[model samples]
Target: MNKNKSEHTKDDNYLKHVSQIDQVNFLNFRRYLIDWYETVKRDLPWRKNQDPYKVWVSEIMLQQTQVDTVIPYFDRFIKQFPTPAALANAEEDQVLKAWEGLGYYSRARNLHAAVKEVAASYGGQVPVDKEELKSLKGIGPYTLGAIMSIAYNQPEPAVDGNVMRVLSRVFIIEEDIKKVKTRHIFEALVRRLIDQKRPSDFNQGLMELGALICKPTKPLCEECPLQSICLAHQQKIETTLPVKSKAKKQKKLNYYVAVIESPEGKILIEKRPSEGLLANLYQFPMIEQTKTDCSLLSEYLSAEYDTNLNQEQMLEPVKHVFSHLIWSIDAVKFMAQASFIPKEHQRWVDKKELGDLAFPVPHQKVLRQI
Candidate 1:
């Protein structure tokens, strides 16, 4: 209908500009980008090989996490669960423990589940076909595309936030990048622009360009490979081209954490439920409440832990930000002598034993005080 025609016209306009690049310039474009990538690409451990498992692990870890933070975690993760079979065979607690400090516990859980599927069905080999890869838990389009291009060298577009920003500036696509539909448009554009022979390098180059040159603020236009052909640069609007709406504000809540020490010098910690936030991780006794009064802590301890306690000391409130929520914790220290046997998910551990248990970052902070 009329809407289809309008969409067709818009695509035609964009391709018309693409068609304007002469064969020599097009060659130079690819050459400059790949050449720059070869010389300046970061010496990341994942880039050392075309191993699909390593690339898959790196891609999952890199989501919503920075490279500097992921490197050590990645090393330890691979060392523990080196293969699909290894991860699949490992216990859920082991997987979550490895992923303790790296927020987004669901990613680790889903990854563990998916790898189990791979072991069961695919014989520990990560699937290369897009549909099969998509069948795994937590493997979305962006992740599938990343595995396809980087690991299999397929001509698929790994259009993440970095790729979106780079392409938006280069082609001057003014649509709001936050819209889901915008992602499909950019994916198609990347499908056309991606180097067929070296799709891996091409996609990585775009990511690097966005991360380094075509930054969200203070873009280095002069050094960009596509500066000569960039529509945003020509229009002097590189900074404003990739428009994105602000994210929804995270819900804020106050939590009261109790650091209860036993007479035997062991600390009491509770395990989160098998589902929901911080699932299966260890944390000190905590209750979410609006008020910061210590009276609530005393009542909670007596009711739940079956030990009467007074807040002997109060520490500075800890501020922890999850993607969808913010936790301001008011932690207090208490000492108790009890004969009660530990619950199934609760235990008392000394400093040496605490080292082996997986404590989430928030509880890790409280542990330092004890």
Candidate 2:
């Protein structure tokens, strides 16, 4: 099938518009964006210095997390692990504990591994070379761009969601931002537009503009500095410009969470497998089942641990949503028979010791019920 005449014309016009962002316009963009950023950019903790270690840690924590939520965590984490060597020398459990309540436990795990590499190989210095930085675990293109431009003041583009939305509107790009190819397109555009003298400010300005003014919903277009140049605003389509495809529906699973306690008042907890979802985290022993039937739970306890559920009582259900899945957990409390023996990867944790272990948020919800 061929595009109709109007569609062809629209495509031609978009290309022309993109091409029209010449050097003069690029200079103007930098002036407006950076000037605005210098005046109004939020005074984030990480912005205090160009330390690559702090930048790397903050960027990792900021992934899939909001800025406001990350502030305290960043402060506490930096206070605890002041240097790459500090984080590298710390135990994985300590890192996870500091990262507790921050979802995506894998980020903490990967950061720990990467920082250890930095300590061992780079003598506690974050690699300044692009290839060397990319060699570290969990450092992808965006993170690499951020470190190079922000920490090293190199001319690189840190194209994140905010930058994509801002640029897509400024040039009227219609590519689906969710696509990997679309990201490449945006990165190329940034490479062309970035200011060599002020790459840090330029990249951060785009992020600030999108976050503060070019928001996903109810964009403050009138307040935007780029209002005069934004093709989406000129066309009265600012809200509709950055085309994004809907994500796939999250798969849902149900489980029966056992909040069993011994007569000595120790809670039963088990370590999850060392890989996969919520890896290496601790949780109350749970069994996957369709229904929340105590009899089924009782049978499971009897079969697996040779334990009987005494004084069984149902607690409130807990629902946790993950990026790709949902957990609908039905929690129940019971006293295990005194003769029960702990299985491998399982333990009876005293209430005070629970704080020392890292449990994922869903299990944390179950803990609150007890």
For lDDT, the strongest prediction is 2
Report lDDT (CA) for all predictions. Answer: 0.83, 0.87
Candidate 1: tens digits of C-alpha lDDT, residues 11-63: 55544544333332456667778889988899888888868988988988999
Q: Where is model 2 more than 4 Å wrong at Cα?
A: 1-24
TM-score of each: 0.90, 0.93
Model 1 TM-score (2 dp): 0.90
Candidate 2 C-alpha lDDT tens digits along 134-174: 99999999999999999999988798999999988888788
Clashing pairs in 1: none
Candidate 1, which ten residues in sequence have the lowest lDDT sum? 17-26
Model 2 residue 87 distance off true place after TM-score fit, in angstroms: 0.3
